[model samples]
Target chain A: MKKIESVKNPLVKRIKRLQKRKQREKEGLFVIEGFHLVEEALRHDVEVQAIIAEDNKNIPSNHSGAGISLVTEQVMKEMSSTETPQGILAVCSLPRQEKPLSIKERGSYLFIDGVQDPGNLGTMIRTADAVGTSAVILGEGTVDPYNDKVIRATQGSLFHLPVIKGDIEKWIEACQTKNIPVFGTSLNEGTTHTAIEAQNGFALIVGNEGAGVQEKWLEQTDQNIYVPIYGNAESLNVSVAAGILLYHLKLFH
Target chain B: MKKIESVKNPLVKRIKRLQKRKQREKEGLFVIEGFHLVEEALRHDVEVQAIIAEDNKNIPSNHSGAGISLVTEQVMKEMSSTETPQGILAVCSLPRQEKPLSIKERGSYLFIDGVQDPGNLGTMIRTADAVGTSAVILGEGTVDPYNDKVIRATQGSLFHLPVIKGDIEKWIEACQTKNIPVFGTSLNEGTTHTAIEAQNGFALIVGNEGAGVQEKWLEQTDQNIYVPIYGNAESLNVSVAAGILLYHLKLFH
Candidate 1:
């Protein structure tokens, strides 16, 4: 383990700025905080390049993740965005992206269109795992999966899932070719998923947080669904809608 | 607008520590910063004990709901939890018991049970307004809806609805006598709510972040439903589930 104490260190500055989308892309890495999350990364065989934890932090008093780094509370705070820093953060390789049209080897998969919030993206990932979705495809305009907030919000599930960045048009073509039925969520009637029987081999298309799926993507839908609402909220947050749809698909199919 | 420059000011100090829940309750008032949120609080008729904004630095913009206190950018930062303070915060009287459950009222209502995260609670409130849920009821162990983070996460919707704090058991009784249906979201039973059907009088009961509704609350359900999962996430964030259910309820009925 290495000790990093200087706030002025160039590597520290780079880690601090990883919160920004542009910086994330520039450095090809993002920050994941909290012990549970870092441990998940380790278990999944995801490459954790380095770690920074609080001074005098506990490490099972027995074993520790391979590349752990110790830092002063002040140094940890410098790299943290949360008010109560967890005293642990990891610099890890962004999950690799498979081809957009690529079919998952098994089970279910997810396709998100323009989900902009980091929390929503992270929550969707965690919920996807709960429902047994195989992989996640990020269509154009989706938020950066590597954003610090998104990583922390995923609650460590990020390391377990196959979340890939890709193009919607390509994804549609691929799913169609693979015989995977593509479903989309809509405010209009494409299919009433509640009653319609679900089958194996499928991927659901969740739209932008506000706009729904881009109008054109609806053309690819074998089933277009909507969760029933009793009130006047214009739409559900993207992640929530994805969760409901994803969970329903797994349960019924 | 009366300007407060001292960090020693009890109110300012209290506002700064709102990141911690214990401090927030002991102070009996939570801090709400930024123009949009404060504006929403004012519109909602939430009682404001004080106002510290940029323009009204002196003579504190005193009003019936709020004691006016004005301050400069530096002072505002001293009182804000956000890194980029928006030059304003109002110490509003914590809203009184939020449950406005009256099935006879013929509107959509939300029952949030132990949804722990403040952001999730706040986001649900924002989504509630978007979906037109009449009000929100805080079940046991639910995070305080008035916490600084929760208020901020509500966007401007914190001011749009009445969020009640109470025992759901009694509220369930009120709904029962009034003949309003009480529906709980769970991991089992009811058909997929692909299309939300809003009824004249119904309450949507949501549960914890990971676990669905508790057994006690589930017993009170007139209907038990679950959102579908098409992906790998294990569960939906409670707020996201609430948003989806709330929207679908309005869409179909």
Candidate 2:
């Protein structure tokens, strides 16, 4: 039970640095705050490097054997990204999947392209997890999945599934190689999503909030589909659309 | 054009006050920022009280007959809630519907119960709008629809439909009077969403992020339904869940 009384402590400084994308990537670690996320990381056997709790807060019993640090509330506040810092936080090693993704014969997959909003990206991952998607492949320009906002929005689902940053074109090719149909969402060019019957294995690509699935990616997809807008809304929220599409493709015909 | 050079100008102060829920309710006015939302407000023929634009920005031509005010960049920033003020905003008379909501024979409706997140509430409204829902009834404890975050998340779908703050019990009674099957989402006590055949006209109620729909409300519904979670995630994001349920109930038979 090491005590970090100052925000200037080396360990505290390192945790704070992990808030930045570059620092997280360079060090191959990220910080997760709040008791729920910290617990989930430990439960999932994610490399829990350290558990930091504010002084006087009881560390969970399961944290036994993990490195623990007791910090002052002020230090915890400095280390936390949220407006209200939860008493507990954890530093975990970033999960690395060195092997390239292999599209399975009977699973659903989500391919996200240039989704800029962290909340959207995270919720999409959570939805993909909820729908039992095999993996979530992030294309270029997607927000970093380890970003605090994205992790908080995922509500621990990030630990539950493989969320990989990969090249979309290559992933599409892999799906094609496996004879898995890939669907791209488009506003103008595609048939309604209902037109595509649910299948045992499929990949659905949802794109940027504004630009949508890139023209190049759409060209590579086996089929392009859209959720019909029956009312005056211009389009569905990207994450919401992903949920509908994932559930429909995974569970229904 | 009238010019508002000071943040303390009565008009600027009044507009800023509208950002608070109390002031908005008292004045029956809300402020919307950014070109897209302001343009949507004008296009939808909403009661535009005044258009506020930063000095030197060209106001859109569609703003012809509306009251227009030019403000300094500082003044515009003072009146805007977003970090980057978009140079344009509008003070709109809140759309007031005096008559009670009458559930139609062939229309879908969304009822939100105690959803606290503004982003979730707004996104759900947008989803309901996309699904051609007749109205979105906000139950007690739901976030204010006119809150800036909620309005931004709605992406102008707020102007496209009736978003009423009302009693959930009354709305459920109205739906029952019309014999529109009301579906309340629950994790513990519902048939799978797909278990019930989609209907042309129905009412769907989704609740808070952490808690499912309230027990009292769930008891009032004609059916309680849940989207199955096939993976390790706890549950779907509230807005995403609404999108899935709205699309499933409205489009799939």
Candidate 3:
């Protein structure tokens, strides 16, 4: 492979356009940079369009296994959003759940109704992976999972988990039809998580970062769990709250 | 009282300089941005040298109660590290823990030893606040709590909680001498967290991002608790793990 030095290369221009969600979806791919993420893609067997390494150094020996390309540092930087680039980037296929999950099939799942912060949503997905969540259902208003910062924050767990995007109301209804229980988190008299049995299989619903689980969703839920605050700090970060509830559910698993 | 228009204005220059650790220490002040954080500082009554609202066009009436200096939008943009400025920023004192806690007095506490990521450390502190931990001890290698990103993440929980910075070795000895049990988390056979009476006065030691808990400190701890993993992802992000454990332990509190 020869290094492409110009920033104006059509490939580079196309890749740079990936910063926009429309571009990413239109191309059916997302770009992740840094040496670690590239390695993560291969390790997870995610589909890759190409490996783009700048500086002509530290290229992973396995790059040859995939369609690899050497890109100039300038070209790579033009495509990366991070302030510091690690001389490596890759375009990987947007992974989907091998089979789109019906609420009935995913017993231990997380429903993200409207988590807007890419980092927060990413952390929750990463936490979901740690706690053995079956999948993450992106409800209305949630940020795109493929957002570069989110991909980075997931620390490659993004590859391992099935994060399905769709109408949350429909998903919730599907779960209801299938007898799959839905547990929403709220600040009110929602049951304390310790008192609930998340292991038998349930979908954990986490709401918007600020607005919280919508009132309608909370009303529709089979159970509402709260982490119970003993202090006057108002509320916990949404991702942090979801993480705690997810781990609590794991107690039964 | 007056809007400062230039990036090079003396006060603006000082604020920019305080972005660095050394300058912040020399000045005994740090700046925190975003409307949420400034409100937190206000609610907590942390001393504020000034509240600078860059462009009052979008400042909600509630965010203006502090007599904030109305500055040009450009000045706010210059002072902000975030791509989008939150319109409000504050220069606040580095608050000391109001009730300093030693190991013996702890029922449940978190010791973040050597956590380097400002966002992770801040989330841990925020988790500590939500779970009602006795204190969060920042040992060697931890990022300063007042780092702009961290302070924002903490959402003023830094002010609500006992957040003390101290030497790692000294804090370890203090715990041992006081006979307060230590719980270190690891991938190995640290007891599964769910099985323990985790609420009993213990200090949970979380360590650096790359390195697990220090072996020396690991040896000093009384009990080690591990959050069981169900997936191939090697580890949890430090803050998420901390939040899970902290909230889990709160079941007893």
Candidate 4:
């Protein structure tokens, strides 16, 4: 085991940089903290570049195969995004899905467009995974899935399923081309989601919390759906809306 | 209009104290910041004690009848909970519902048990409101709904519906006595949520994030329901799960 005792150490500095979107992209690596996320990453076979633990913390026996480094609590805090460092963290390679997803596959898909809140994005991904969706595609302007807040929100579902970033327009076109119905959420000029029968496979697009699905993409969807607001609320939380729609589309064929 | 230029002003100090649960309980007052929330409170006919705004900010014309106070920007920041003060806030009396909810009403109700996350609690309340739930009953140990993060997450829905804090076990007994079926969520020994037919009026119980509904409550419910997880994700985010169940219970028969 290697030991890193200084916040000034290059490895610690590199981990700190992973906090930013640009840095994560530049390095093709991101940080996962806390015991559960680290264990999930290893269990799911996410490439573990290194497992960093605070000097007083014990690394799990199964994690011994991975390259391990021990660091002082100060050094751990320097690399942690959370207020209280979890004492264990991992640097894992971002998973890449080289193949374009096939809509003909027998599973639902979630496309997030310009969702800015990390918690909302993460919860949506977890919901998608819970419903056994095929994948979660991040359209341009969607918050980075690797964002620490977003990752924490996913509760390890980010590793359980494929989360890819791609062009929204292209994914919509692809779904339409393959005859997989694409449903975009809208506040108006659409049928209620309950009116749509379940499908073997489909794509659902949810948009920015404030702006909703873009008009251009709504035009491209086979059908635009809205959840009826029976009360005085202006709108449902984006992630909650996604969960309701996803479950309906998946379970009600 | 009273002008409070000092953060130490008695009124400013009192407003600052509204941030704590203890202070809020003692005063029977809570602080709601942001332009939209203040507007919503007024629109909903909530008892507005005072409207506080930054010196240069324009108070809405319709708000002229309410008591208004002008504070220096620094003073506003001192009383604000958010990173960026929205330049306006309202100190409103907490609405008290003296009568216990009747389950015989033709609407669903949400009972939350020990849900600790403010965002989750707020979003669930918003979802319940969106579905036209009769009311939201917060059991002991649930986060204070008036907490600023919970209030913000509600996006002003807090003013749109009834959110009462009470005993979970008693609420369950009340529903059963009224012959209104109560649904408790559990991970085991429960039918999938879809298995239950929708009802005209029902009570749904969601529990703590880590533990499902407490065994005592689950044992007394009409039926315990589970949302089937089709993928490897351990569970849905609590708010998302509540959204799915609420929509199903309200929209389908």
Best model per DockQ: 2
DockQ of 3: 0.65
How does each model score on TM-score? 0.70, 0.96, 0.91, 0.94
Error of 3 at B159 (Å): 0.7
For each of the candidates, the C-alpha root-mean-square deviation to the true structure, in angstroms, is: 6.2, 1.9, 3.1, 2.2
The C-alpha stretches of model 1 lying farther than 4 A from their native spots are: A1-11, A20-23, A55-57, A60-65, A96-100, A104-107, A187-196, A219-224, A251-253, B1-109, B114-116, B126-134, B140-161, B172-235, B243-253
Clashing pairs for model 4 are: none
Runs off by more than 4 Å, candidate 4: A1-6, A55-58, A96-102, A251-253, B1-10, B55-58, B96-101, B251-253
**In model 3, which runs have C-alpha deviations exceeding 4 angstroms?**
A43-45, A55-65, A95-106, A251-253, B43-45, B54-68, B95-101, B104-106, B251-253
Q: Per-residue alpha-carbon lDDT of model 2 for A206-226, expressed as tens digits? A: 999999999999999899999
True contacts kept of each: 0.60, 0.94, 0.65, 0.91
**Residue range B100-212, candidate 3, lDDT tens digits:** 54665655678887899888898888878877787788887889888888987887798887788876666767776777777888866578887776555667889898897
In angstroms, give how far residue B22 of model 4 lies from its true place. 1.1
| Residue A58, model 3: Cα distance from true site in angstroms | 4.5
lDDT tens per residue, model 1, B1-253: 3566777778666667766768766666677787767766666677777777766532233345576666767777777888888777777766454444455467677889898888899888878876677778888899987777787777767777677887889888888788878888886567666644657778888888777688888887788887765443445677767766775665344
Q: Tell me the lDDT of candidate 3.
A: 0.78
Q: Write one digit per residue (lDDT tens) for candidate 4, span A76-193.
A: 9889999999899999888655457556556678999999999999999999988989889999899999999999999999999889888889888888787788999998669999
lDDT of 2 at B251: 53
Candidates 3 and 4 compared: the better one by lDDT is 4
C-alpha positional error of residue B232 in candidate 4 after TM-score superposition, expressed in Å: 1.0
